[model samples]
Target: MIKVSVLYPNSDELIFDKEYYLNTHVPLVSKLLGDSLKNAQVDFGLASGVPGEAAMYVVMTHMSFESLESFQAIFEPNSVEILSDIANFTNCQPQLQISEIQI
Candidate 1:
């Protein structure tokens, strides 16, 4: 399996609407991606390892796919529409990474 990680960095100046992301945005993604998306998990960061440290990312939405082709097929066609939805939820720019599952 392969995983696509969408990481949103935490920022004092940025605004993220958790309610809209979870309720509206995520569902929209699932609907658009369709069956190509095997599964998905959304992580909400609370803190770092330290007692008083900020989390590197406020949100990480990890999506699983059977293969890169499956991911690309959906992502390539709908990237514009899907990506544009970000502005409705958060102001922070997201970092994206695609990784193979070693374990």
Candidate 2:
């Protein structure tokens, strides 16, 4: 499996609407990506390992696909719509990573 991760950095100026991301944005992505998307998960950062430190990222999303090609097939075509939707939830510029899942 291949995994696509979107990481949102934490900052004092950050303005994230978790409600919209979970309720609206995620569903949109799921709908667009369709069956090629094997699985999807979202993570909310609470804190870092250090007791008084903040997490590096405020939010992280993981999406699994059968392969990198499968992901690109769907994502590339619908990228404009998917990416444009970001403004509805947050202003954070997300960092993307693609990886082969290792078991």
Candidate achieving the largest lDDT:
2
* lDDT, candidate 1, at 65: 95
lDDT of 2 at 45: 99
lDDT of 1 by residue, 30-56 (tens): 999999899999999999999899998
Candidate 2 achieves a global lDDT of: 0.96
Please report, as a residue range, the 10-residue window in candidate 2 with the lowest summed lDDT: 85-94
> So what's the TM-score on candidate 1?
0.96
How many steric clashes does model 2 contain?
Answer: 0
Off by over 4 Å in 1: none
- State each model's CA lDDT, in order: 0.94, 0.96
Q: Which tens-of-lDDT digit does each residue in 1-103 have in candidate 2? A: 9999999999999999999999999999999999999999999999999998999999999999999999999999999999999999888899999999999
Best by TM-score: 2
- Positional deviation of residue 58's Cα in model 2 after best superposition, in angstroms: 0.6
Q: Pairs clashing in candidate 2?
A: none
